[model samples]
Target: MGISAAGRAEFDQCRLIDQVLNRLGNAMAINRLIIAEGKDSTAVAAASDSLAEQNESYRRTKRQRAKAGCDGWQRD
Candidate 1:
């Protein structure tokens, strides 16, 4: 029972990881467009700060999952 519950939790986490990967791709494209626009310096700075935090969190999760022996994940 405990083992099945753990497996289910891991499956949920894998789904989350996939979602994060998709959002990260979107974030990259948004960042590029913001850079190209070259407007709203303060807003861009704030957004960049927020993105840095999110990137750190995403990386942390990826690292933790990797340590847990999760597979099929890669980072650029």
Candidate 2:
């Protein structure tokens, strides 16, 4: 059995449409993943900056306390 010319053309057109839709869906998914990763990295960077600032502040306070002789320890 053989497919008619018209039927084969219709099948080809359907196959092309399916391929385009699949590619579009994959592109959208990849774009979403990239955006999510960017947001996560930004959040992590902000948290890291905050932690570093807090650590610096703590160190400054410790130095002041030691300088005032309230730490009961000598700085060398």
Candidate 3:
């Protein structure tokens, strides 16, 4: 038998979540590399601050999407 519509939707949601998590992991790795390769404290701090802002923005967008029922998962 084939999967139901709900099941397929759940599968798609899970896949999207995994893809998001993978991208976060890759971003963290890149941030680490930046810090490790930086020559001075100021350089590292600036990069860290920029990355932190980007992460916060991403989180804010996700929260907005979730609130609007636009994210993959059902809210209610």
Candidate 4:
């Protein structure tokens, strides 16, 4: 059976949410490792910070999207 238009939209939204969440999770893991190891290199620290920012941005964007009517995804 083919999916309805609404169902397809929901699936796409869910997929995008999943991808963003997975990226955030991976970034968090890497950030944790960097902090745990007590790394002091400028490049490493900068990269970690960038990852954190990106993760937060993704989260905020997801929230905005949800608030705008894409309610097919759930937060962890």
Candidate 5:
């Protein structure tokens, strides 16, 4: 069996929308972490750890947005 053209288009559009939403969610989470951790070193360190975990989670997302297609991974 094969997908119809319209079905394939819908799948692609859905995938793109999902990617955008995930990126937005990641950005919002990072922003909240920054705001909540703005005062203390301990909180900053904990946020650093949290960001590190998020970096791993969003590694592919970053690569997709990178200009050179490299992973372009970073700690911050």
Candidate 6:
């Protein structure tokens, strides 16, 4: 999106901040899911995967994971 070097740097910095905030929010949501769903790995994994799909960073960096192609947590 940014053309100039300084502009790109600023954009990256802001993007990093957004990513951090998004992860924090995801963590909170998963924490609540755990509290609600109990110690069920399957459900938690599914919820986390769903959250990852909704996250900009995860969607940008792990497109394959989004499609459940990787060996990581994925739904059937």
lDDT of all predictions? 0.72, 0.56, 0.69, 0.74, 0.63, 0.59
Using lDDT as the measure, name the better of candidate 1 and candidate 6: 1
Report the C-alpha lDDT of model 5 over 1-76, residue by residue, as the tens digit: 9989976775676567557648757765875677576887776777777666666666655555453323334453
True-structure RMSD for candidate 5: 9.8
TM-scores of all predicted structures: 0.61, 0.48, 0.58, 0.63, 0.50, 0.41
lDDT for model 2, on a 0 to 1 scale? 0.56
RMSD of each: 5.8, 30.5, 5.0, 4.7, 9.8, 11.9
Which segments of model 3 are wrong by more than 4 Å?
Answer: 40-43, 50-76
Candidate 4 lDDT, 7-68, residue by residue in tens:
78877877787677678777777777776776677756876787778777877877866765
Candidate 4 vs candidate 6, lDDT winner: 4
- In order of TM-score, best first, we have 4, 1, 3, 5, 2, 6
Q: After superposition, how far is residue 7 of candidate 5 from its true place, in Å?
A: 0.3
Any residue pairs clashing in model 2, and if so which?
none
Q: Which stretches of model 6 miss by more than 4 angstroms?
A: 37-76
Query: How many residue-pair clashes does candidate 6 contain?
Result: 0
- Best lDDT goes to which candidate? 4
Worst 10 residues of 6 by lDDT: 65-74
- The ten-residue window of minimal lDDT in model 1 covers 67-76
Of the two candidates 3 and 5, the one with more favorable TM-score, higher being better, is: 3
Candidate 1 lDDT by residue in tens digits, 6-58? 77787788777768867876785686567567698976887677678767876
Best by TM-score: 4
- Candidate order by lDDT, highest to lowest? 4, 1, 3, 5, 6, 2
Misplaced by over 4 Å in model 1 are: 1-6, 73-76
Error of 5 at 17 (Å): 0.1
